[model samples]
Target: GKQITHNLKSRASEFIFYALALDESTDMAGTAQLAIFIKGVDVHKIKKKTETLAALYPLKDTTKLQDLLEAVT
Candidate 1:
């Protein structure tokens, strides 16, 4: 438990870029599934930069997901 807790705490402030994919599951269920892939440097300094950017301009859902993905990439 301690190891798990420590790992989670250490990663809490990490900056992660997620590549998301949304699609319908193959089971014929009328539901959608979202897949996320996260990758980033495992360092503390990046967290501070992320915080600064977040403070300056918060994230909003004003644009379509595809447009947002295009802008970020």
Candidate 2:
């Protein structure tokens, strides 16, 4: 993209990723996840990404994040 390709490439190189599964949803959905590998994903970036995704996909109620994770598993 004519966008921030440099920054994107730099960030992309920072961590390796592995596709976890094809799809986790019971019904047809495009939602998927990536198992972030490599190292150096320090707390700051983790917090930032968590907060970013949390804002993007806010949990409507207290469904226990761990349980939601279990559902995916």
Candidate 3:
């Protein structure tokens, strides 16, 4: 897991431009979860890469915009 994080950070540092994707969902227990992904192109090879940056389970009950924002920040 640490290696994967390192690789993602290494690639991200070289990104020319990037975009983020956020997914919010509720589990069977009604717990809200947020998943964040990043997509970008590298500066050197112009290679495109996509990676999952985080999966956050906010302590709050709902997955509203405010809740998501709080989870991330």
Question: Which pairs clash inside model 2?
Answer: none
Candidate 1 per-residue lDDT, tens place, 5-63, comes to: 35334544465532222222222443322222334444555553222111111123334
Best by lDDT: 3
Q: Give the runs in model 3 whose Cα sits over 4 Å from its true position.
A: 1-11
Cα displacement (angstroms), candidate 1, residue 50, comes to 17
Off by over 4 Å in 2: 1-3, 18-73
Candidates in order, TM-scores: namely: 0.24, 0.23, 0.62
Of the candidates numbered 2 and 3, which has the greater TM-score value?
3
Candidate 2 contains a number of clashing pairs equal to 0
Question: What is the C-alpha local distance difference test score of candidate 2?
Answer: 0.31
Cα deviation of 24, candidate 3, in Å: 0.2
lDDT string, candidate 2, 1-73, tens digits: 2222343345445434311222222213443332222223434455332101111122223346553454334
Q: Clashing pairs in model 3?
A: none
- The deviation in Å at residue 7 for candidate 1 is 14
- The clash count for each model shown is 0, 0, 0
Answer with 1 or 3, whichever has the higher lDDT: 3
